[model samples]
Target chain A: MVRNYLYILTGVLFLYACGSCGNKGASGTNGLNDIPDDVVNLGIAEISEEAMQGFVDNMSSPVEMAALIKSLNVGYSNKYLAPTDKIEDYTTNFQQAFSLGVYGLDLGYLNMYNKTNTVLDYISAIKTLADAINVGQFFDFTTLKRLAQNNQNLDSLMYISVHSFNQMDNYLRKTNRSNLSVLIVTGLWLEGNYLATQVYKEAPHPALKERIGEQKIIIEKLMIFLQNFKSDKQFQNLISELSSLQEEYKNVSITIELGEPEAVEKDGMLTFIQHDKSIVNISDETVQRITQKTEDIRNKLIRK
Target chain B: MRPYIKTIFIFALFLALARPAFSQDISELTAQCAASAGDVTYLKDFPAKLDAGTPGGKPPSAKYSMLLSKNTAYRFTICTAPDSEGEAILDLYDMNILIGSTYNKATGKDYPSFDFKCQKTAVYHIFVSFKEGKAGNAVGIMSFVEKL
Candidate 1:
């Protein structure tokens, strides 16, 4: 009887272990479904979804941009953010997804300045847009609202808010809605750049200027991803609009110099010192042109 | 016979209780790891649950591609799950080159996290794995340190 009981217990453990193994398999390609049937059938050859995902994934987070702006002592301004009242105007999934990105960046900016009071408006807007796109499950609005109400939990709020968006993006890509994912990414990039450029117009910080110029690399990659979905008229229009902005970026030059890598172990933490340095050369004239063109493109996208 | 049945029932109850308790521990572990990132702005989290590979084979690892900007300081933090026996290591690579790692092989030491001051605007890869091909679960967090 003892032996029999032991056998049963071992069998139960084996099954439990097997249950955990279910997650291992080929990654689902639900994202491919987002591609238009025409593009797939016509053999126009869209970039692999995985490659596109990599492009979207690598874009710098808006929070980083907001943090840098705050670090430069730039005062928080609501003028730079897409107005929350216009959420209803974003009827189309394209517009909603794009606006979601815009508001997401705005939320980052607000959080950076510790403007928790105004955060609820943006959070509501984000939740509405996310729900419209069927990715609302990722955001816990209740907890976010609670966190936003308390300044002490700013770090937790930031982490949860960023994590929520990351989870939503992953879900969108995992499902077949990468098209929306791309738009969100583009929207975030546009808003982040817009905030930086607009602030530079007022403050004119050199670090901020160089940061704006660095978008030359980012826009190049973003354009490639947008071009992959050029089969759609919306994407085509975006590509056309961004092409002008991309042209403006041509004047901004960036070059890198490799340096010896050094590693330091301090207080049980490893720090890898990057020796490579990049030289960004952008004239004020070019920045002005980029700024004007960024405003133009961003306005067109956000306008009702 | 009754005693044997009681013993089996108790064992089953323990198994049911342990699963959720372990899951809760992992959740707490992940939260603690995220908190350990300090005042840096959180960017993304990479959750990896990996099993040991074949004997004498390369250890399993999770790889994520990130677009790191030029002149930006980024921090990578790793935390092993409570139930895991293996300690997780994170490696940052630019293409084929290994640029940084949490563990220094020669010194036989492991660090909880590492900071990378990226100098180029390009796509980089991060790999997370356990030492010596051991099975484990861990959460890797990437946080923005500052603009360097």
Candidate 2:
């Protein structure tokens, strides 16, 4: 049976790759770049004074910036979002904006670290700066979905997630804890898989999902690190957020079970799509506690 | 140049219709592939030569210098790297001849069957790339065929 299946698959591939199958017409391209700057503003995140001085001192050359972006895995790939123009925008301007955002913070943080020599102090100050900027509310899930659907500025979404991971990596490095730094790096790898899966699940495609799943083991390992290391502040923040999100997920699970929206009231709101429309439902009290935990992390960032 | 453009456009029209219909058996085959994030879209030129027999993930390093012969039917496929698993737009040319093209979202390691016929034998080039980044990813290609 397996041999027969393989033959059938090969035959199908042969027929599909050859001229026997007709063309599937091209999808419409995302129109030209008219995205406004305000849609992607780098908010008021305070960096350490030493970090800022360091950034100014080490003014990155274009070559260096390009290399950094490439190393961070922040380039456009033609295999996912297309017509080529969209990819170009992502690989170009979006990358620039992200570099600007992270560097702006990195410079300040470096300065503070050099001046104070206390990593915890730097983290607190940085959190205070992040809090002032209201960064968390910048791109909600809905905004992200819209960008992915329109194929506009999706790279920004990617940049933010990866950039955040990089920020944590930098923090871990400053603390001189090589072990936690590895965990942070692992999280970065896993986050890519998570983003790909989230994108594929919204729009069902076997090939795309399969492509996303190719990196699943890495992502699962990242999740394991997040679960295991609770002392790391950044990991703690991510875990808290993921836990709250899990509550939202549980509401959906309950809906799937009981056939109707449950009236459970929680502090955090979970929204999922059903039949092409977004359905919002409240979470249970357990979910609320998770939300509180997330809020606490957010508060610490703001206070610091 | 304008007239040459018109001639190329008109020839493209003819190639589009004649190859798929009542065309004679041909020795050459045509194919097209789109760009992948992994496919090096930033490349300004094609590899010197490509041998289909090499293996997967190993593209030809040499640029193609030969064109297709007249009366040859070709097969084309489009795909993207998993990171770029989505829509891919393809346009084909044979030494400035607008041969044919197609698109596909069925992401895999291979392209879809959107084949065409070649009416001339010369050193032809195929250009494949995408405009989007981190999402609409694809790669496509065309290959020759023979009867033995």
Candidate 3:
């Protein structure tokens, strides 16, 4: 029954994207003044408190990590991406949702490098998984494919694609489906970190190493989000496994120095300059532990 | 001869056209707003939910809480519904202290976006409300420029 409702909701949502809508004050049961019942019936994601929502809001998108990898100027490498063919093995909603996030970041990585040729493969995989979970409506495939084909407008392509995922994430949470949101976010971060670790192993850069170590802070926040659904068996398994990584992260520490913020007017906009500095300390042993544990967790997620 | 068939067909057509009247395209708003943040490498954005207003009252304000990492430069941009009657204002705050605002309330001028340079890495609030007690559809995008 839920699946049937979701299908209807997807269809209605896709068809309802032309203008502005309100979730209130319909004049009659079938009045034109009201938002369609199927849409309103798409109950908000079951967010119990503002804190959980905060966790979702506060968690960083994989785009930043992917962009950082690109900054390394090492050039694009296919080995860093989650295998595109791995999409089919993820048949369950949990698997599909998680891999959707994994691939979303992969798409970002591809987008950053002007690697337009390969972006479609990841997009195809993302569309498949998104459709399986009934959230494909948020993806504008026709427009996105068009954008992907024209590599000159990489900015437009990246914006549309990322914006679509953000909308899907919002829809899931609004419909009380934070369970899926949790998995998607986890998969995104996991793949991002996985990429970072791989890059660091190949060429040890202080910048990349510091970034990888600083993920300790993000992992703490992610753990809190997962614990929000610990009662679920899958979430429980994730928490237990990730907690080990957290324990390993405990071996690392980050220190910061305060600095003054400078505000300047540029191009008729206010641009503030932050002056704080942070130092991350990670031992060789801790790095190895993190690399091993992260790979293990990711392998389990993909059933590799 | 086919009155009922014609009625059903008309109803379906109305449904198709009427959707925009009742829907706010958050995705498009976010994308457009993000694009407007020129030259700033993209990071992430916070999508705010603006409620439909009551007959005459102001729509409830939307508050987005975020962790603005210290030493990082972030920008907040907004794009209100194309058909909106007024602009929505974005105000930045920390523990009730007014850090900055997109609209100069004193001057009655509005800006589409504003940037923040963080001296402290802590959770801050990005409050969204309509100007002059008015309300309508809008989206606010937060992006990173640099982390110092």
Scored by lDDT, the top model is 1
Task: Give the best candidate by TM-score.
Answer: 1
- lDDT tens digits, residues A96-175, model 1? 88899999999999988989999999999999988777667677788999988776678889888898799788776666
Model 3 residue A10 distance off true place after TM-score fit, in angstroms: 22
Show model 2 residue runs off by greater than 4 Å.
A1-225, A228-280, A283-291, A301-303, B1-148
Give the higher-TM-score candidate: 2 or 3: 3
lDDT of 1 by residue, B11-98 (tens): 7757745665564565567668888988787788777889887888999998888888877889999988877878899989988889
RMSD of 3: 7.8
Better of 1 and 3 by DockQ: 1
Models 1 onward score TM values of: 0.84, 0.21, 0.79
Candidate 1 Cα lDDT to native: 0.80
Q: Which of the numbered candidates is closest to the native, going by highest DockQ?
A: 1
lDDT of each: 0.80, 0.32, 0.71
For candidate 3, the per-residue lDDT at B107 reads: 69
All candidates: DockQ: 0.37, 0.02, 0.28
